[model samples]
Target: MPDLAISATGLTKTFGGVPAVRGIDLAVPAGSIYGILGPNGAGKTTTLRMLLGIIDPDGGERRILGSADPLAVAPLVGYLPEERGLYPGMTGREAIAFMGALRGLSLAEGRRRAVALLADHGLPADRPIRTLSKGMAQLVQLLGTMVHEPRLIVLDEPFSGLDAINQQRLEGLIRAQAAGGATILFSTHVIAHAERLCERIAIIAGGEVRFEGEIATARARLPSRVRLSTKVADGAWHAALPADAVLRDGVWQFQLPQGGIEPLLAALIDAKAGIETLAIEPPSLHEAFVAIVGAEPDPVAEALS
Candidate 1:
């Protein structure tokens, strides 16, 4: 096992006596990328905020970088909240320096680092943040988050307003940071962004952690999808498909049938129709997300049936 970067046990919170986050437990290893995924109002942001010490957890304890008391370890961490805030009156350089200073750096050192950050992140140095595009503004914030050279960085919705090109750039930067030994914790509704970067993730819903584990482990829990294509159409062959098979564009796609693939493969071969191609689409992060969150329906109406 890798060195632990963050650990929280029985972390709970509430708003107006209503439970906002249940007894959630999470662990992130050093030098790895971790993602928190959930729908809107699922308390992901709230959990991250509490972890960053911007807000206190109503119950339980959170340890950062091995220190169970996070407040004493603030200098080793960097955080970017979901709500982006910058001094509109200040130029990009000054705004970034201000953020760096808040994280414990001299004004001169902060300004110098800010200038270098512009070069590193490919941002215009002299432009005021208010005059920049949202994508540009997001880049500036990302730079600010890393300006102080912290070993642990947390970002909330880092790709909210980025274009395709910018998103790719940010993704590359994240990979580079982890390779250099920084533990990254970020939250996003966009699952594809974490496809190649995240090693582990926590899926949250209704203020509770529904899932927490490595990306591969989460995927293993969901069966692989089977897709088939045939060179010849045979109505009788269609009848041989599993009852739950989904017919799409003359192709049959289905979850791993209850009997598994061997029986299905044998039946297809016995059908006597020429086979063109057979493919198994791996379960994507997006599909897993939908399966977990979308499973909760209105039971009041569903039970009436």
Candidate 2:
């Protein structure tokens, strides 16, 4: 197993006597992309804030980058908050350099790295942030977050407000960072991004963890499906299918049996049924997420307590 980049045990938080994040455990391995997934108000942002030492947890403990005091090792961690914060009057280069400076980079070294990062992302280093488009400015903020080359990157709602094209760009950047051996921990209510990028994930619901494990394991909670279409619409072979099978769009779709598909295949063969199509469909992350969390929560609910 890889070394842990972030670990939390019994982490809890509350606001005005109301629990926002109940005791939760997390283990994020180094060099892996881990996602904290849930709808709004699931305590994702609160949990991240506690883990990053931005706020004190009401209970439990957290270790970041192996340091008991994450604030002490702040230089080794990069954070992109849900609220986009960039000085409008600062030039793109200055903005990036400012972030690097906070992480212990000298002004001169920060400027040097900022220039290269701006050019690499196709942003003009000298352009003031006020003159840049919203998407461009957001990218600039992300560049600033990464300018110091921190070992662990924590982002809250990174995809929020990004257009489809910019969202795709962000995804590529995340992959590139992980390829370079950075351990990334990001929280998102948007499930698709996590589904595509995460190796492991923790699902939060009602301010508590619903599940935590490999993405494949979460998906395995739901059974695979088999859609079969036979030459004859109704036959003895139909008896071999589960009682819950539903015929839709000229195909009989049902959950695969526990023992295996072999029994069903054999039963069909014995009935001498002419089969036109037999397709097995694995459960999707969305299906798994829904199964774990039940109905989706309100999208605009407050995630922070």
Candidate 2 Cα outliers beyond 4 Å, as residue runs:
297-305
Question: Quick one: how many clashes does candidate 2 have?
Answer: 0
Per-residue lDDT of candidate 1, residues 76-151 (tens digit) = 8988888888777677888888888888987799889889888877788898888998888888888888888889
* Model 1, residue 2: C-alpha shift (Å): 2.5
- Model 2, residue 181: displacement in angstroms? 1.7
lDDT by residue (tens digit), candidate 2, 258-291:
8778877887778777878999999988789889
TM-score of each candidate? 0.90, 0.93
User: What is the TM-score (0 to 1) of candidate 2?
Assistant: 0.93
